[model samples]
Target: MAVGRNGRFSGLLVVAGLLAGSWTGFGQEKKSEKVVVAGTPAAAPVPAAPADSVTDGSVTVGGQVIAYRAVAGTLTVGATATQDATIGFDGKTLPDAQVNSPDKDKPEDAPATARIFYTAYFKKDAAAEHRPVTFLYNGGPGSATMWLHMGSFGPKRVAIPDAEHQEGAPYAIVSNESSLLDVTDLVFIDAPGTGFSRIYGKDKEKAFWGTDQDAHAFERFIRRFLSKYDRWNSPKYLFGESYGTPRSAVLSADLQNVDLNGIILLSQILSFDNSVDGPKWNPGVDQAYALALPTYAATAFYHHKLPTQPAALEPFLAEVEQWALGEYMTALLQGSELPEAKRQEIATKLHGYTGLPVAYLLRANLRVAGGVFSKQLQTDEDTTTGRLDSRFKGPDLDPLSGDAEYDPQSQAISSAYTAAINDYMRKQLKYGEQQTYLPGAYSDPSFSWDLRHQAPGGPSATEQEGGTNVMPDLADTMKANPRMKVMLAGGYYDLATPYFEGKFEMHHLQIPQKLQSNISYHYYEAGHMVYVNEAVLKQFHADVAAFIKSTESGK
Candidate 1:
């Protein structure tokens, strides 16, 4: 999720996070060690945090006791046998290695480039090289995976009463019976400078701070991970959230050498064109308005703001979709050219659908941005709605302000997740690192990101514009691997990455009609983090389980 300039929670993260890149062929032979040339004088050593102690744990699920081991450690990347991978490196073959061990101290002889921290859970009963392994990460470009790690699919989950309410502190974590472990083993990743991941040596932040570079780093990590654990032949899947959705798509396209059985995208934003148009209405395209209308209707319906509320979300959204594409699209296309009579008619309907006053709708010229709708929706109560999940509301200090003071959507869950992950690392997982865990870095310079990405097939301007939009790369990946399957999960209440945007991207993906059936979509009643709501999570768990089984069985 994008942390806004004023510390409010925004839509998809615009800032790019650091991503380490040392691309090497998974099957390539290891290079011989070379002498290290000391660069500048070494800085004084700071004592390392106590080493992570590998631990064993068991949880009972479905009447079965599943034994698992939790391993926490730093995985080294972007380093050559002797020299840093960034030093004297060509574009091709970024000969790199990854060492996932409990010890944090760097070996005197080992090459250190970047250190990535991760917490892994391996099922003891599963066959060594047969069971499926899924790699999970969240998107901020700068966000740690803790949201998905502690709030959703992880074995232990942070329990909050509701997304609309804050949790009382000294909060607690509960065993997630719906954890994906019931079907597949899981690994949660923390990219550089997030959580405990760090960059070493003289390598610049640019190495892992861009799109292609980030994907390449993940590719290196996945390859090295499979090789290290002897799971190269194991069935693989990528589970990514928000920005991680685009990251997953790009990684799927880039890892042509490594076969991925399936991909699960949560709160996906496949294209930036749709995302950038979310909070604000961008001119020249009816796509954004048409897509966002359904979410606006859903949020309005949830708050009972809609003049004519439907009994159910599905029917309400389905009706809104029709109007948004039909009358709404036509009126928006006309702009000022629309007649006063037609404008009044459309404004009335928009008010009915969005709960914004007809006069205000007319004042907006028939387009109400998400933020404006959020603040205006609850103006009577002198509160503002959340961008993440409009179901949540908070009082703005300055009620007269047009914008929301803060995102109640972010505030509603951030504390529970932040507290749960920190406590779990030291208490449950036995990670002894004294380093402060950064859930997200809003102001960190390293989090200042560049979105430009190298196109998959060749140099193309379409790929260059809005570097975060990886729809083309995803389409290319599907074309190359016709058998690769994708399951997209979106929230109807999610204004951040509206469900209709996912629908729009799929329609415009340009994949051959025959291969189109390989992609599937699911919708939830909750917002961006769909799993935060337990009822929705049950459906999420079931859908994921069925998808994993179907893909693994080659169905």
Candidate 2:
């Protein structure tokens, strides 16, 4: 479970990489769509949902100053109160088991055990339930919602000197005119154990830390949030990055009983079958290499490393995609049985596309893994391209190592996000949480996470033989909710969850042929966190705004 600062893999280098809108007309289309642990508390009663702390704010976007209300609050889930699992600086337990679940479907005596913390901004004058509401979160399995909260979708964003440089403090906070606030309401949720959220007990941590359980908790939280705010009638959307993409997919299935308008998957890693650095001929290697080739080409093109640079990006990408799926895939499927001359030809062609040396490609059996490419691509310059964003380069700490030492892309903007989130929560939003805001990186102590999901038998069954792969979950969700539309956004340089992998997953989602068109793909010139690139950020906003508009129009 490699997790990066914003949307990186659990152990992988940080790569990084929002919005909302409309309804009534789309509602006519008739359709649409789509955590944790804690020990069993004593006989203590469950608490009601926490009162929301509201603050008024205004931001001028697209020449309009939209007045809005920002509500910072805790929404309780489960059957008992949230306990402070924090130790007294020495790992001592501080249990506060008074929080309770408001399970309307269960008995009044039903228990509640966890509390979710969220910040919501809504246009004050807009129609309450008519405006679209997009719930946003980042994936670290351990990450908080801060990245999307302050970096992209929120009204205020952190200003960095440049996305490729270390944004040292004191960083500036500026208005994110590109924010989706103008088109939709936003609610940024800090996943349990991240940000101000907490579960009642240590034992409960395992429950919230897993795949299916995590989605269940979020589903409950969204239902409760809607009930509390009287937003059940609003057009709902889910926006997730990195690991959050899988969570979004599973959540869509969990909420299938409810109508969901759309889903936004940014920098998605829906399938974990792909490898970054490993033996190249494993069971999943063919699929992994095939999916990665186009991205390798994209990165090589970005750096002008390809033998013959194409004049334009899209047509060049089409060429790579065609090769990756055609001859490249056939060669990989042949494996060791292939003739040396054939392997040599494939290796030479791979070199032409990936900018990796033909000698190395031949040695690698014509498979150039991600980290290998990241380190070897710029060998002459003694630099390592970031696994998160190959466009960002750093010193080659261990030039001999197979992987990039650390993600320069993660380091580049970490300071700005950390400082901005801390300031925005306390100063502007008037949030009073005293706990540290965890930025869901793998380095965090609490980030020790579980990737297991309940066996196919149901939520209470044994583990599935193979580990987590949520592609089926997303496909099933789409199948069950045909009206729900999806926008899969990818950054050409995002090695962590390469754009080509997303395309592969979408193509193989195993849904109906008609349903296949339900998911659309968009590419950015940036990396995992495409919004970090200013131009891409604006384009992201525009693209997503259009997506939301389209979904509402049922087109």
The TM-score leader among the candidates is 1
Q: Count clashes in each candidate, considering only residues at least 3 apart in sequence or on different chains.
A: 2, 33
Q: Per-prediction TM-score, please? A: 0.86, 0.84
Off by over 4 Å in 1: 1-52, 79-112, 276-281, 460-463
Give the per-residue lDDT of model 2 (tens digit) for 86-185.
2111112335424343344533243324567899999998998878899998876667777788878788998665447763588888988888988899
Most accurate candidate by lDDT: 1
Which residue pairs come into collision in candidate 1?
Answer: 16-449, 19-208
lDDT of 1 by residue, 1-555 (tens): 456545543443443311122211011112233345678345333234345458898766666678888888765566432333333221122435343321334333223345567788899968968898999998877678888898787788988877567646877798887787878889899876678776544343556755676777787777667866789888899999988988998889878677788999888877665652332423655567678889988998888987877888898788888888888888888877999999999989888888899988888788766667778888999988877777888887578887565678786677777788899998878784567887764445434455667667656533444324688888888888788899999888887778888887887887999887998999988988888888898789889988999897556
lDDT to native, each model: 0.73, 0.72
True-structure Cα RMSD, model 2: 9.6
